[model samples]
Target: MTTVQQSFPVPPQVLWNALPAGVTAIGGQGPFYDAQRGYVTCRTGMTFFSWGQVVTAMVSPAAQGSTITVQTALKFGVFDWGEGKRLGTRFATAVAYAAGTAALT
Candidate 1:
């Protein structure tokens, strides 16, 4: 089990909207926000693993900006752990890209 955490300052809606679209194809989609929880899915590639699940919890907001924290737990069944790590890395890259895109808009 590995835990990855990141925190940055950005407008709430900017981060939220950018995040879902970033994770669209690689087993990530359908990001919904609710009063209690935020729901999203992440899938690892077949090369390394079959599937991956990432459940994110929306955190509190800052005065000037907001923070979105995602905690991902990888479960690789009959798959290479390296693949899972790569997927995680890709996800992070996507998040960073989202942030950058939001800044541009």
Candidate 2:
């Protein structure tokens, strides 16, 4: 299991949208998103033989915009090879870019 947290300068919904899109861009699949709960779950799976991954994200209102907490768990693994950190960075960058674009528009 791994956890990554980031603060975004956009509303929760905006950040939420950015997150799943980034995840999808990098092979994440079957995202179950819940706006009311500000939560999203995506299956970051590789081979069908494996149970895959459960990537859960929590987006909450924050001082400037929103705070996102991402929890990642593989179906079964001894440890992660920094994949969680990579995913976290990817989502954060995407969210920031989206927010900046939205603000400019």
Candidate 3:
């Protein structure tokens, strides 16, 4: 149930290409892309506990910049805490980096 949200000004395609490879390698699930669906999917996993893990992401383009949001639900053992707890312990480990390949003019 943990959620992490971040927004920065970046060009659309530059952000898009960086997403798949960047997110997955951090211990998430996929570079799930569907042209028709028009989005990319990413997931995260738990170590010893199944329910403690989570997977969530969003991909969209806007006039100013592209937006990507990633979220995961974490369950610690038998305890089901909300997004805050899960995000603090589990989701924090996941790292994503974005760099602009070229300037947009």
Stretches of candidate 2 exceeding 4 Å from the true structure:
47-51, 101-105
Off by over 4 Å in 3: 49-52, 62-64, 74-96, 101-105
Per-residue CA lDDT of model 2 for 35-89, tens digit only, reads 8898878877664334466778788988877887878787777666777666666
Candidate 1 lDDT over 15-100, as tens digits, reads: 66656644653466455556444434454433325456554535346664665555455544653465545554555557657777
Better of 2 and 3 by TM-score: 2
The Cα local distance difference test for each model comes to: 0.51, 0.70, 0.49
Residue by residue across 59-103, what tens digits does model 3's lDDT show?
Answer: 557655655555665534544445434443232223234344322
Best by lDDT: 2
Instruction: Flag clash pairs in model 2.
Output: none
Ranking, lDDT, top scorer first: 2, 1, 3
Q: Clashing pairs in model 1?
A: none
